[model samples]
Target: MDVVLASSPVDGDVGCWDLQTGAEQMRYRSCASAPHGLASVAGRFLASSQVGNSSSGSILYWSWHKPQVEIKSFPVEPIVSLVSDPDGSFLLGGGSSGNIYIWEIGSGKLLRKWQGHYLAVSCLLFLDNSLIASGSDDGCVRVWNLVSIFGERDNERMKDPFLFSFQEHALRITDIVSGFGSSNSILISSSEDRTCKVWSLSKGKQIRLITFPCIINAIALDPGEDVFYAGGRDGKIYLAALNATCPSNGKFDEYIITCLNEHSKAVTCLEITKDGLSLVSGSDDGTVRVWDIKSQRVIRVLKLRDGPVSNILLVQLPNSTSNLERVAKLPSLDKNLDPTGTLTAIRISPLNGPPDFGYCSSRLMLNAIKELKQRSSVGAMEMELDRLREEQRVCAQLLQRRKKLFDDLWRARIDTLLDDDQ
Candidate 1:
């Protein structure tokens, strides 16, 4: 399978690398400023936006197959985030100005601009063909109706405002994601307040809140939709289950079971393949690691020459079905079935494609287990710290009340003494 890693250089250019061959596929120098947002459509085209420079902010669309000429340039504000529709017909760009612009991919025409947010729109996600959800720095998530925007063929303008606005986060929403699991639509948002919240999109109410130790940069959900992965600024990756129901007392337990601690820097982006067999993680350390989800180990580490990897994507090639079938028939090693010295299918072939690096290190597994224990201990300590902070706040409020009460009593006593003197 071919994987693509797109990185926004700290200096200037945007670098795209091929993961399989560890080669520099292409570099685009269109963004005079640093590119903060990147999105791909139809697995053959990409759109990138500059972080700042409102007047000069532009989105560059380029073809991945050719990688030579630019497809089109759409002028918009410095885009903080971008997301393409599932069908790749429409591309949505959101900027720090709290405005969302929709563009037609094939025609390169601006369809409509969504305006209503009072602050910057931090994140955007296309829920379905007729609906879109946006989270903003104003601490509210607004669900927009795409049907109303494009209903009139003569005038393709957004006539109606946001359908519903829900206030959940007390801080800016960093990322918003939606998943369909168990016949339910679950929307999750990570924020700068060190908390991740899950909302029911249909009901427009929050169901659960997952708090973390540090600021969450990004979140990824498994294809099975049973688990969610969150990357924090503390250089830690957390895995939490979504099957746990909310509690009656309006409190639920969100625990992190597994942590990937190989990277020394923050994990910027994460993506899971369509089959959900593998996961790819990009870090500020300028390295991308492909992980085996079942084995819980790193399969391959692709190091980049310059700049940290801002995003990592797993694109299935055209001939993936045949390749997958060939790989599946290689061998099977079932020791339990061959206990009586029976020959197994794996024994027939002494050599395979490449050595399984995931299983080669028992020491790494031991260290990971050890670190997991340490993190659990640290998490307990963090909880204790939170308890102490809450207590301190309560104590301060009590102290202020007591001081007021004492002053009142003292004033009353003084008034009595003045009356006696009179």
Candidate 2:
């Protein structure tokens, strides 16, 4: 497995963790306080946002072999969000001044800088090398086309690289994540307004706006893009369907498929593994939980520091054949068994893990629903069987009519032959 890296700016520590043994190789420092500012550079090095207050912010790059920062670049403004390009050629930072700074990684040279929004930029991501998406405190999401901006030879030919803006959330943007459906496909943003909005880049409009009962702190999309997990401040993770119908008025109960309450404190951050099979979540309780997405259960939990769990990263170590073997050993959808054995209910998995044991677990609800539920299941099955028999009878009658028609056609052909002979 890749050494999962987690950071706590308050504790001034960056730790390398593995699931097999909970022993942590944490490297603590005094000058590091960047929240949600750590990103891996293609397994080569780690990049993080240094504590930036206003117009004075810095980004540091540390080699994988060393504990000290190998390179540093100080931008004019304080940086709140940091990301590296796919190829690790350049780095991008969203600043407090609502400006984006791009620098070459090899030689800390400023490549391109642009004023992105009207307020502080909260989150930033590269949709691709040519296009990047940014979210701001002004409650606007903007897309910039690097090709159009850097491609221009003259200022007259240079149109504004701003491609599209999605403005729907009524509060400060807390987190923005891309790479869901396709390249520049779907962008989901979380906010303090207790809503997560989905924007379709190809459609150039907002497709869905999901409202919750509490402020959604973090979000992660499933690999299939059919559903997403929203981690909330209420200490619950709600699973919502994307294709499922929501009320036209946007106030009714949207299709929340399920909720996972594995954490006791507020969920602060979330990240899905590369294969999207597992979800890593950090909480205010200072624990990093690994969740089995399919089984909707917690596989492992690592308590790192005493302070709040601020950020988490799941990486793939170089010798990761064991991870692949574990993935292959995972039981199929129908098997209700969580291979991790965290949810150890002794029962037959009737295709969907343990039979809604919740149905039988609660004394109050079980007493209330037992008789009605008993009658409903058996009655529904008998009704369905009767309907199937009626459908089969209709098929038999249709087949007889077709046979009669075929006999008539043969009789007509015989009469024509007799007339020719005469």
Candidate 3:
């Protein structure tokens, strides 16, 4: 099921709704989330970074059907952004102190930590399974290759740690979104400078600088990469041309193909549905609006009625996720980085490869266990256990006999040595 989630800084609940039916789901409560800090952890659970004034901030996790937080971890520094890879094996937290921390989600072990930006990290996006793009308050957007960062040896020297760094925006970054390509995808970043810059990952250069009428707080790319929707502080969502070229008229108004003017306040976040037919946006007006892409009209409006919506996410949850299943199989997030700890989580391959992650394999194992429980009886299981114990006893007896034989052979050799010496 495809669901859209909205979070607010002042609100205690994270609002969730069905994208297809526009029906409200279970509202995950007690979450005052930071902007760009809400994420669906590979459909297993929901996680959000809390808005806190303290030096240390916390990240909370809630089961899909639960309203209360099930797990919480305080990081070394306040994290402003949180994201997980599609495989759900690794969770990345961008700290307020410009450091990015990667944790193994299965074991909750901190795998790596490095300074990713000059200022507070604003947003983190996965370009592919192996590449991640981070935007910061320093107005710099950098792409990091996870293969080199995580897989490379400490003694080995990387030619350049960052794959690409685009420092075109003059103000703090508010949001970052990527287009359909893997490593060669086009990255779009919205900033407080009233501009949205598009960078080419393959080319490693700024391709387009779009000047908006207002500071674009959020951006959502069209599935085809033909155009991108930019939500401005002026309460308008501007559809800017991506493939089509407009004659370089110096006016910023020329870049806008059309605009959605229903939002009464600054649009805080934007997300396009999986089918690319609907555009969902959250705003300061405490409403989440879903717009039909073809008609460019609001089809559904979900009233949050709490505070300004800070983040929005659209994710596909598995149908098998039972509401009755309370405890999540995943581990809790670790409070601090453990250098001596080992990451027992099964590592995943690149996005293009076949499935080998723990979550995917775990589902299969769970299904097998359910099937076994249904087919086997208690008496049959006990009989099987007794048979296994008998086999173990036989092996133990054989080992003892072999040890006695070896000891006897050694004594015979020692006696022969004594006779030869006499």
Clashing pairs in 2: 2-315, 2-316, 2-317, 336-353
Tens digits of per-residue lDDT for model 3 on 306-406? 88899898988766654325335556677665655444544323447443334323345345555666788675565456446656975685566456435
Clashing pairs in 1: none
TM-score for each of the candidates: 0.66, 0.69, 0.79
Off by more than 4 A, model 2:
19-23, 26-33, 52-55, 152-160, 180-184, 246-252, 319-422
> Could you tell which candidate, 2 or 3, scores higher by lDDT?
3
Instruction: Please report the candidate that would top TM-score against the real structure.
Output: 3
How high a TM-score does candidate 3 get? 0.79
Ranking by lDDT: 3, 2, 1
Q: Local error of candidate 1 at 31, Å? A: 5.6
Candidate 1 per-residue lDDT over residues 35-135, each given as its tens digit: 23777654545566656443545556554544433543545456666778776656687767777777655334465665647787777777765568888
lDDT of 3: 0.80
